[model samples]
Target: MPETARIRNVAVVGHRGTGKTSLVEALLFQSGAINRLGAVEAGTTISDADEDEHKRQLSIALSLTHATWQERKLNLVDIPGDPSFQGELRTAARVVEGLLVTVSGVMGVEVGTSRAWRLGDELGLARVVFVNMLDRERADFFRTLEQLRSQLSPQCVAVHIPIGTEHELTGIVDVLHMCAYASPEGAKEGEPGPIPDDIADIAAEYREKLLDAVVETDEALMERYLEGQELDAHEVAAALKAAVTKGEVFPVACGVATKNLGTHAVLDLLVEGVPSPAKKGSPIDVDGASTAVFVFKTVADPFAGRINLFRVLKGRVTAETTLVNLRGKGKERLGSLLELQGKEHKPALDYAEGDIGGVAKLKEAQTGDLLVDKEVAIEVPDFGFPEPVMSFAITPKTKGDEEKVATSIRRLAEEDQTLHLRRDQQTGEEILSGMSQMHVEVALERAKRRFGVDIELHPPRVPYRETIRREARAHGRYKKQTGGRGQFGDCHIVVSPFEEGEYEFVDKIVGGVIPQSYRPAVNKGIQEAMHHGELAGAPVQGVRVQLVDGSYHTVDSSEMAFKIAGSMAWKDAYMNADPVLLEPIMELEASVPDDVV
Candidate 1:
């Protein structure tokens, strides 16, 4: 594994179609990491290599890749921008030190922009918003900057201004150095050139604005600038980086990712401008003790079993180490370490602070489990998952498929945190739920692809409760005659509502009318019978049954005979008890669009 100091872990976040994945490809291409860039529509991009992602034309999971720039190793994570895949975004946040938020110059200040801003704020990550898509029509850098100021935050300031408008984007003005960088392909370290003739005045104006934003971070710089003293480029860069990493100032840069414009320059800015993990705050924790690693995703394979992806927070982890699972409570051994590159895994032995990696199947370890060193037990807080809002009932097609359905559902749930599968206790139906209808459909697709389990989905049944409205009495008798022996039992039961909310069973027999041993058998039968109501086959609730009187034959009576008698009595009494079905009304507190509400 690589040391933390040599590693640059940064997350590329932005709205959909802002060219985040394309920027990643460009970075890889220029860094000599990959020979050629793959297109998103072709479903051959390195980051979006997953089959499900390719079919959907979007990233469903965080894609982890690495590249090297100027002797420094960069760990790049490209995250999905869609809300349904926010799980991937959260995973990326746990592993990176700085955020590179991409914004489309054509569509400024979008919903994705607002979301990424708030996410970075919540994680306390240093931010640098790259305004991309400069060559497209209606792509106004200045207008986009104004929109960012109005909708996002006023702390944003331009550090680099484009040289010209659309179709004429040949270079950019460096505000700090008072220099112009021209690129035929818009890459960094291109042949140095004099400031372009047309945009020199505009560059001069923004350079002062850039200097003003930097000077506020240091009193000496502020005084020097206010007194008309000129500061050098090196001094300016240092102050600007400090302010940006400290969340005082957010410097915006512009480029066209698809045309390979300004990508290398953006890479340089990330390496030089972003903060290192050591300078960042300590890792996240739950209690007073330092945090242990918690995995948010696991991929099950027929050959590999399970590949668990996780982030190391407070401590170092190596192969063959044992950890106590605060959730699973069993000791888990760290298997072979893995660094994910596209869909492949590169072998490693250990990982350090703020590093993201994976390990082969850890028996008994699961997502949301805090893997402690066992000697020093500490628990990390679990990651939050949105509640599943949509549901469907799934049934298998083939004979003897009922048991396979449960196993397949569990495996699918293990893979997707957003998916939930459980038996509806009230309705007695197996329900699979997720964020939306499409989410559940994707889960079904994965089930067929990964687990080879085919299922038919139907609307989930509505769960209802059943209760009795009046009291009733029932007497039941059970007798079995055989050649050698006989069985006889009798019981009288009184059924009524128990305060209209509680379900209880009481034995009030006196004078040894029925043996104490037989009383439990009667209660068991009533409890078992309560599982299915007489109406609509729903579970019965809010009622109590009492065993009042009964007689038993000394030699012939048995527990089975008493149970049968009690079950019969309950069924007979239930019809006359005035049972009614009660529909469940969910008291929902939701924050939706005002028009919908």
Candidate 2:
């Protein structure tokens, strides 16, 4: 296990088309973790392995991959950009202390960029921006830098500037050090060189901008610099790191992830500017001597059981370690831990404190589970997943495949907290809820492909209800005489709209007109009637039924008879009370471009 301070957990996140996964491949290639680089369009990126991800050419889930940079381990969590997958971002934030937010050099700050920035702000994570796709058409580093300053934060400062623009892009200039690096396509390392004569003035201009922001972290350095003294490069670099860790400044770097341009600088930035997990501190309060691990993500593998990915919060974890789950209170024996590089699992020797690793076949563990030493007792806060924004009714293709369909979807929901599966009692239809339409569709597709269960999806039932609009009265009398004993029940009820709440029953009957025992039976009968409304067979809502007066025979007025009388009285009054149908109405706010209007 490496030193805890040498481990840096960073999540790579950005909008779609910003080349986040491509940049991860470049970092992996530059660090020699992988000999070849993979493109997402070709379905070869390490971050995206699911079949649907390949079909859509998008990242659907978070992927964990580590790169060895400058004798340090960089745990790079590649996250999806789509809004539906924001749950993955929250999961990554809990374990990582730094966020490497990718931005398109062409489009600049977009919806995902803003969202990622706001998340980092909320979590107090140090953020670094990478302007990717610098070699694409209409790509402008300076323009994007301005956008970052205006849209994200005025504290945004450029540390690395592109040497060229668009198709002629070649390398980047390290503005802080007044140095240049020339890294062309397929270059593993940026060749150190002098600043080009053509862009020397511009590089100097950015260096001053970098210094102006960096010097504020140290008053003495700022005073000396203000006195016209040249600050030491090392001193400035140290201050920059502190400022970034404190979120006083957000340093921006430029790159074309596809061509591996400017990737080394980003890796160097991660090693230098980002704080280690040990320095950032853990979210869980654990005893110093005991080991603790928080399971942030789970993969439901039908063949391999559950693969749990966790961050070591306290002590080290090895092959012989036994952990007790805080939530389930079950002792889980040690299993061979593995490192998840995309879908490939490599044997991991051990996990040091604050390091993340995956283990398979735990007896009983799920996402958000805190597993620790038996002696250590602590409470783990949940991930607090966002509610699903969309829902669909699901029906299995085969008549008897209901259990299989529900079981598969529930298993997937365990892995994806944003995907929720439930059964509607009113309609008796299985409903699947998710962050978006694509989120639900992808889950259903995965269920069919992996679990061998197919289901049809459509709009969920409206869950409408029925409520009365006016007041009406009716009398119900039941008298059946056939032999020595006869059945007799009489009751008068007034049905009126109760706008405040659902189904209020009042007994205004005085004296022995309706017996006390039979009164409860009448209320029970009215409650049953509330389940099926008179209009559209929907559930009844917001109506009050009152038993004002009635007469009952001494022998024949049993609870059953009174119950039947109450049922009859409710139906008669409901029909004359002018029942109305009610439906759920959704309130939404949308943002549209000006031209669309």
Candidate 3:
């Protein structure tokens, strides 16, 4: 097992198209985890290996991988940038101690960038900003840094400045070291050199500002700086790490992830500046005796069955351990412990406290579940999943495939918490809802491809109702005189609008006018009529019926006869009692960009 102090769990998150995946790929390559760097456009990046994600050229799920840098184990989680996959991002945020938020230097601050920053603030995790895409045309690091200062926290200070702008970007000036590093095309490590003459003044200015920010975090350092003493670089570096851990400052770095430019510096900063899992705090309090694991995600592989990815919050978990699932209150036998690398898994002997690992085929365990020793019981808080905004009514393409479709939907929902499935009680349609149209569409595609279920999508129907407007009375009679035992029945009913509930039936007949046994038949017939309303064929609501008078022959008056009379009486009275169709009204809350509104 790896020592807790040597583990650095950080999540890479940002807006879509901001080079988050690329940055992760570059980090892996620089650390020698992968032989070659993979590009996002080619769908070969280790973080985005899902077939659907490859087809779409965007990340649809969270990817977990690890690298070793400077003898420190860095566990990196690459999260989807799209809002539709915010559930994955939030889960990643909860497990990691630090957030590496990448911002597009060309686009500056976008909506996703703001959201990523807010998530970090909410979790109180140490944050580091990477101004990516510096090699792209029109990319400006200083402009992006200014935007971060205004939009995010003003505590954000630059630790590294670009040597040039846009296409001319070839190197970066390390402000803390007061030196420049030349990064030619396709180079993994930049050559250290003196600061360039052109941007020397600018670098010095930012360096002074950085020093000012760093000194404020420590009183002794502040005194040294105020006394006209030059602060040592090592002292400043140590102070910067402390300040970052305390959330007093967010150090900014720059890189072009696609070209692997300046990534080695970023790795050095991560090892030096970010806190270990032990320092960031554990998800659960350590009780010293009991074992605890929090399952953050579940993957349903068609071949391997259920795979649960979890973090050991306390104690050690080995292959022979048996855990109790707090959510289900059932015993779960431990399978082989595994560590994940994209879609591949490697068997592990055990997972120590503060380490993240996976277990395959836990019968009763699920995402957000707490697995602990049999003697201990605890509930792990759930990641807050956003409400689904888009909805679609689904129909099985094959006539008898409804059950198959439903099973597929459930499995898919298990994989993605953002996807929701429910039967519309009013419309009687199986509805699938998600964060966006694309989210639902992708789920349906997965259902078809992964589970062999095909379905057609349509807009959900509005559930409407029919109600009575006024009160009216009518008499109905049924008689047959063709045979020896003829059927005969009669009834008089009064109908009116009701406010208490959907529909009510009352018996007002007296003196055996309607027999007590036959009254139920009359009520049943009227309820059937209400189900198929007089207006628009919608279900009837807000109405009442009263059986005032009725007559029946002793031998000829059967339950069927009375039921027929009740149905006829309801139809006559409903026509005279004015009725109207009521469409359902739903209150909705919408979120939009300020410019759109």
Candidate 4:
């Protein structure tokens, strides 16, 4: 295992289609982690390897991979940028100490970009913004940099600027070192050289701004800068690192992720600028000799069973370690620790503090659960999943497949916290809800492909009920004559609007008009009638019934006879009680464009 001081855990996050995945691939290739560069269009990128992700050409889940740069192990988490998959991004935020937010040079600022910035702020993560796609048409690095400064934070300043504009983007000028790195077509690392005379003026301007920002971290440096004292490059770099660790500055870099240009510089900056896990300090206090690990993501593989991916917050975890789940209050025996590379698992000797690893087939462990030593009790904060906005009723395509579909959905829900499943009691339909319609569709596709369960989706039905607005009284009687015995029963009931509950049945009989044992039978029959309402076959509610008087034959008027008489009396009173159908009311809030409104 790499030492905690040399391990840098960083998350690559940004808006959809901002080339986050491509940037990760470029970093991996530049670091010698992989010999060949992978492209998203070719579906060969290691991170976006899932079938659904390949079909959509977008990441739908969090991908974990690592690389060695300058002898420092960088654990990179490539998260999905689509809003529908924000849960994956939230999970990534919890484990990583720093964030590299990518902004498209052409698109500038977007909803996803803004959201990522806000989330990074909430998590208190040190951030480095990369202006990507500089080689694409209409891409402008300076314009995007200004947008970032105006919209996200004024502390955002460019440490590196593209040497040329779109179509002529061949190199980057490093403001800190006052040098340039130029690359030819299809090259991985650029050759360092003196800054071009044409770009030197602008590079100097940004370098001065960078120096000014870096000095703010120290009062002595700021005083030296005001007095026009020359500062060493190493001192400036040290101040920049200090400011970034405190979230006082967000260092900006530029690159074309698709072309692998400037990626080597990005890796260099990550190693030199971003803080290691040890430097960032532990998120929680680790005073005692206890172990604690937080499970951020759970994978439900059919063949492999449940795989738990967790980050060690304190102490050490090894094979055969027994940990207690604080949420479940149960003991868990950890068998083997595995290092994750996308979906592949490699055996790991142990996971030390500030390290992340995975284990297979954890029975009571799940996402957001904390596994700790029995002596320590601690609670980890959970990711706030957005409420589902779209819902659809799902049905099995074939009969007798309901259980299969349900089991599959439950398993998928275990993997994705954003997917919700519930049964509409009134409509008797299984409803699937998600962030969007496409989110639900992707979940269904996974269910079909992974679990071999086919289902049909439809709009969910609204549930309604029936209630009375007025009161009425009625008399009901039942008599029958057969061969040697005769059946006879009579009842009188008063029905009124009930304010306390759905329905209430009161027994009020005098002089043994109705037998004590038979009163309960009357209540049962009324309940049955209420369930199968008289109008629209909906359930009846908000009504009360009082059994005031009744008569019965001793030999023939049994519980069955009283039950039938009670049913008749309820129907007779309900018809005269002025009943009305009540539709379901939904309290909803929606956001719409002004023109549409």
Best candidate according to lDDT: 2
Write one digit per residue (lDDT tens) for candidate 2, span 221-248.
Answer: 9999999998888999999989988889
Give candidates' CA RMSD values in order. 5.5, 2.5, 4.2, 4.5
**Alpha carbon lDDT of each predicted model:** 0.78, 0.87, 0.85, 0.85
Which 10 successive residues of model 4 have the least lDDT summed?
588-597
TM-score of 4: 0.83
lDDT tens string, model 3, 216-333? 9999999999999999999999999899887899999987888887788788878777888778768655464378888888876555678888888877789998877777779887
Candidate 4, residue 80: how far the Cα is off, in Å:
0.9
Q: Write the per-residue lDDT of candidate 4 for residues 1-597, one digit (tens) a residue.
A: 888888888889999999999999889988888777888999989888788899999999888888999998888999999989998888888888889999999999887888889888998988988999998899998889888888889899898999888988878888988888885454567567999999989998999999988888789999999999998878888888788878898999997887787787788777767787788776655445378888888886455677888888887888878888877789887786778776666788898788877888678888888888865645467687877878999999989999999999988887788999999877899999998888999999988998888989999986678889899997878888786777777889999999733788998898898889888888887788888678877889999999999898888787877788888998999989998888865568653322235
Q: What's each prediction's TM-score? A: 0.77, 0.94, 0.84, 0.83
Ranking by lDDT: 2, 3, 4, 1
Error of 2 at 126 (Å): 1.1
Worst 10 residues of 1 by lDDT: 588-597
Off-target runs (Cα >4 Å) in candidate 3 are 285-289, 465-533, 539-597
- Looking at model 4, residue 416 earns an lDDT score of 89
Highest TM-score: give the candidate number. 2
Model 2 worst lDDT run, 10 consecutive residues: 588-597
Runs off by more than 4 Å, candidate 4: 184-186, 284-289, 300-305, 465-597
Better of 3 and 4 by lDDT: 3
Clashing pairs for model 3 are none
Winner on TM-score between 1 and 3 is 3
